[model samples]
Target: MKKKFLMVFIVIVVVMTFFTPSYAKNTVEFPEEDSTELQYQDMIMLFLGSHIDQAISDHYSFYLKKDPIVYPYQIEVKKVKRINEFREFHFVIILEVTPVVGPHITVGKDKLIFEVSPTIPGKVKLLKFEHLETHELPPVWMHLLKKKPSL
Candidate 1:
């Protein structure tokens, strides 16, 4: 009787294994690259509360992966500020711009605050550029950043 019970248990195990559906073939696939576009907005924006520089560096790394640099820029996120609701992430960015046309050199440093869309993480609002400080900036950039920043 014990031998018959053991044989029945073994048969049941074999039947269950054969009937189970495989999930490996049905798993959803995601793109291989790490881009900010794929991350949760609040979680990524929440990062600005502490490490602003590192967060910006991580988010923009997708652009840095490109082999050739056109109108190259060395950008540093100096500050991340909160104003009003969670509608936007206010940032102070310092840039060293190298124009693709005339100068292939360190033009100068310009400190500015840019308002970016929180819903669409990387989109910068055109009318929101505010000049905070300026060093020996390029003539074109000097002209652009100098004005009232009103679009």
Candidate 2:
């Protein structure tokens, strides 16, 4: 009985800790730690990976099924600056994604901001996604895509 209970408890803890999503619907506060350029880039990529997995679409380009909205052929990076109360937050806004992938389109089309956390590189929040084009958020992301300010 003891062995069975311990095994069950360990399994539950492991699953909840490792398999669960890094972020929550509510606001999450990050610590005050200076992040390098590489760390910031990692955060962006990590956040993208998490969302890309959840994006809904039937459209496929070869084996990879392209998402309805988040197909990034070109990415325009804005200056990474800290914001909010703590000033540990950094944001990247992507205005366009094109085939040629040069000379960023500053004009408003479809834009989204990726807010990266300083505490955890993997943790990121997708905030304020305004679609100028026909792209859309997936069913799972509809509720999750809202901006979650720091608590």
Candidate 3:
């Protein structure tokens, strides 16, 4: 009877483990309304969370593959400043981003220049994006993008 009970318990545990919902490790979190820079950072994080692997491969790989293998990456929002606010304004987002490799590679200092319109009824567009100078990346991150390039 004891052996039979143990077998049934093990089976139940296995079934529950297989049926449980697995949550993704990374998520995009943003405030409802904040500085333009914060909003831009949130948008970028959302974009990456959706297409992280593909984006990494497109930027780093030579061979094309259906699903590009990628590693865990993160971004630090260094600063957000508003230049001008009219119908639309240009805001600066200084960010530090890490890249991925067979083993995650730390890509050093990075920044993105964004043109954003204040929130509207339904949608927000990333009007323009440009890479900025890579300053000293923390030892954990390896810096790339030597100079600002229009994207």
Candidate 2 residues lying further than 4 Å off, grouped into runs, are 1-49, 52-66, 69-72, 84-89, 92-95, 98-109, 119-122, 135-151
Best by lDDT: 3
Q: What is the lDDT of residue 79 in candidate 2?
A: 47
Relative to the unseen true structure, what is the Cα RMSD of model 2? 17.5
Worst 10 residues of 3 by lDDT: 63-72
Q: Please list the residue runs of candidate 3 whose C-alpha ends up more than 4 Å from where it truly belongs after superposition.
A: 1-44, 47-58, 62-73, 86-90, 107-110, 118-151
Where model 1 places Cα greater than 4 Å from the true spot, the runs are: 1-73, 85-104, 118-122, 126-151
CA shift of 126, model 3, Å = 7.3
Better of 1 and 2 by lDDT: 2
Residue lDDT tens for model 3, 1-151: 9999999999999999999764322323435767886666567666444344334444434322222333323566666566566534545544444443223333322333333334532233333233333223333322333332233
* lDDT, candidate 1, 1-151, per-residue tens: 9999999999999999999753222112345876574453334334332333333333224333311122211333444556556744553333222111123322222333445455544544322223332223344433323232111
In candidate 3, which residue pairs clash? 106-141, 106-142, 107-142, 108-142, 108-143
lDDT of 2 by residue, 31-129 (tens): 377569546645654557545433222211221222333333233344455666555465444433211111221111334466666654565655555
**Backbone clashes in each candidate structure, one number apiece?**
0, 0, 5
Instruction: Order the numbered candidates by TM-score, best leading.
Output: 2, 3, 1
